[model samples]
Target chain A: MKKLSRNQTFMLITIPVLVLFFVFNTLPLIKGFMYSFTNFKGFGSYDMVGIRNYTDLFTDARVGKSYLFTFKFAVLATIVTNVIGLLLALGLNGKIRAKSALRGIYFVPRILGGLVVGYIFGYIFTYILPALGLGSSMLSSTKTAWIAIVIVAAWQAIAQTTLIYISGLQTVPADVYEAGAIDGATGWIQFKELTFPLIIPFFSINLVLSMKDFLMVFDQIMALTKGGPAQSTESISYLIYQNGITGGQFGFQSANAVIFFIVIVAISVFQLNFTSKKEEQL
Target chain B: MNKKNKVAATTNWPVTILLILGCLTVIFPLYMALVIALKKPSEMTNDIAGALSLPKSWSLENFSEAMRVTDFWHSLGYSIMITVVTVVLAILIHSLAGYAIGRCMAKSKFYKFSYLYIVSGMFVPFAILMMPLVKQTAQMGIDNWFGVILCYLVFYMPMNIMLYTGYLKNIPIALEEAATIDGATTWSTYWKVIFPIMKPMHATVAVLTALGTWNDVMTPLVIMSGTGANTLPLAQLTFQTQFGTNYNLAFASYLLALIPILIFYLVCQKQIINGVVNGAVK
Candidate 1:
């Protein structure tokens, strides 16, 4: 009955997990990087043309459009979801009647599969809205279709984001608000001075999270628009799906995906540094 | 004192009104889905503003039709199986690794290395893994439910590990020490003492992971692309596409796909909301 050392016990538990991650995540990532430089058709090997796929990706107008659209969607989704989520959290965290029920109602969509929500909204845009004499269907236009996509993403995303904000709001000491009131600070002043600063951490979490999620937005786009209106609404992730899965340009999309990965990692690092610095000053 | 009361009363009404209006907008699309899902097919043939109004005759026929068209029960079963297996297995493994890092290896280099490794997965968008992962899975002869589940485990490991590690860090070491003094083995102590304390975090992780695995489309889309394997989301997407003109059946299938999750959410809304908050604000 020899007792294992602390590090031995830890390694015993974590080794299998580490192996699974290595095989399933990191190894494939390295392979994906390697494949980007080759002409591999997903399976059978081909010549390694160094950086040709990267050069091709840089010149591809459609891929560039998809990147632009994904960025636009992610930025807008982050802002809208955070603002609305914060507002909901503020209102519902107070002494509202049936607060629990309202929160439940608001969160219903969050639990739903994005495909379902997209299909429901797709029906609304293509059929119901037109039937209501709302002029032309929004999906027929590039601009309005993107707005619809953002709206659906926000509707579902706000549920979890609001809950995060509520948690953040709960952390603010009651006495802080009470003290603000004594000094005649109330309404917007109280929120701007006290609430906003405290919830900034939650704001960053929701921002980066929703931003990342929105950048990879796939299910809803697949169900709703399928990147319609002449492929104007295609997101980067969806484009990768299209190119890699359907188009069978695995090597080329691999190049696009590697670039996407680098951009995301850079953004996340920059965001964390920027927000943590602000959090400190606050 | 009089002025303060007046201000409070006036401000409360506007905020309340604003919240109500916002909630209505949020709920409008869901309400529309319900309306369409309930309407009789015959009654839907020539309706305009009827899309906005309540159904004249409600029936369960559309649901039955949807079920028939999409093999709804089979897909539902598949979705449940995948979600349950992925979430339960992923949680078990992630918590083990998280606990090892949190408790036994806190000061070890392995802890820092594993933590950084797991967190790095969060920033690497799934796009990067799509092409090569597919090839890797094919080479490994794992393009089935097992492969999809494994993919989910790898993809979700980072966040799940983060949640469990953060949770385990807070659990007092005194409890484990007492168990050791009572002659409990390490595994026994974890199962009896530490595991019980982790129930709240377990609930949080379970709800979050369950919802994510159930709603995901991309993983299954790639893994099961040519396999004809359909989860509920995939079923809905394909059904909608095949029957693009059939709004009644499409909406009904959408409802069928969402109903299970919607019910689960209603049952566990409180836990899920708290879970999201706890998972984030750490």
Candidate 2:
């Protein structure tokens, strides 16, 4: 048999994967992009409405609210998770008893389904907290509902972030700390000058990831608030899922989705560029 | 040396106390879930303090009832099948594509373009594709398990391919060159040599994909909602309304959905943590 050329071999290996991606990934994106401009209601009998959907997004109160809520939730959740995760990682990395066991316990939340965790926390907010005389259920009020979501999000998310920080902490050689100690650097100063610079990459990784993940938050809202208390906690993704397909607002929500896509892409590019630049300076 | 030891000893108490508190917060929801799940509805009191106490007669009745109501076995099977199939296929196809791209991108323009095109999918939010994908899958008559699996393959492609390609970089090219010199075809070389060499990456990909697939609710909810099919997470959502105020049944069902993942995490937490860190940092 003739030996396959390198190009032939490459094509042979990659073509299948490429086709799969096109059919399931790229084609839908293109189709969605096209559908966004038209009045396609996710089924038969549709007319092209040009840029009406895009224009409507600006005027639509619900769309505006969803965007606002999503951004707020994402930023708050990212900050909360990262701060708690870093603190926990610092604590876990110390000379604590059952360090590995504690690490494992902290990570338990990461493995459970988001939907399940949401439900469990939903119960806690709805019944347990109220029963404990913590006032009314947080889920019952729009003001505090998002806080509940953020808490649950932080609880599940901190596990992985802490693990990442721990790994980052481990990468900081003990000699660095010993040197700092010799220089009479206290814990806070050592952390500020030595530890922080070394783990900036991991911190940035956690930041970008946490931001991205929280921006697309859906399952938790579904299981907990169902985007309720008058849809105050509705995220961009949840809005797309709830109103776009099910509510027969496909074209309109497709427009929302396109904008959502752009926002995510922009944030990711910005974060990556920003973090890489910071890393270089460090 | 004396100062360093004193500093360490002084800090230990605060760090340990903080970690203990963190551990409690992490375990709080799970503990509540377990306690509530084993109780009968009649045994549950109006007060949160009473809810915190162990059941008067720790019963598995809630589990049995939740199983019957949710058709637990069926959804469990679907979840298992979906996760296993997606993980297996993701590793195989992704690694192959990764190998081709990882090896050839520098020297070949098309391969380079393909690599960028595929990896760029990571930034596009799934919300953008959700509507069109639903329509696309329905049109192709694959709005079921096959479609869900196909979506998972593509959904994971960007990250998985990136991971595999990065892992592939550490593999020496001389090994493949030697295989070629020994009368080995690209196919045989890949299957016999490159594939085995990629086992560690394959494990990482498998764990990540399995966890994602198993825990995901959105994909199945969109693709298979009305088809009398459900993954565990989807099933939990569908029956959530029915569970209503029945915290016992709801918690039991949540625990049921959580158990498999919990077991997997407990057994391979170290690997899971390392795999997640590897995925994130790269």
DockQ for every model, please: 0.63, 0.74
Error of 1 at B261 (Å): 0.8
* Top candidate (lDDT): 2
Clashes by residue pair, model 2? none
Docking quality band of candidate 1, CAPRI definitions: medium
CAPRI tier for the interface of model 2 = medium
| Stretches of model 2 off by over 4 angstroms after superposition | B6-11
Q: Model 2 over residues A1-282: C-alpha lDDT tens digits?
A: 788987798898788878988988889999988989888877778888999999999999999999999999999999999998998899899987778888888888888889989988888898888877899999999999999999999899999999999999999998888888889876799889999899999999999999999999998999889899998999999999898988989999999999999999999999999999999997
TM-score of 1: 0.95
TM-scores for all candidates: the values are: 0.95, 0.98
Quantify all predictions' global Cα lDDT against the true fold: 0.83, 0.90
lDDT of 1 by residue, A57-168 (tens): 9899999999999998889889999998998999978756666777777777778888888877887788778887898889899879988899889989998898888888
In angstroms, give how far residue B154 of model 1 lies from its true place.
Answer: 1.6
lDDT of 1 by residue, B197-247 (tens): 888888888877888889888888788756777899988766666665667
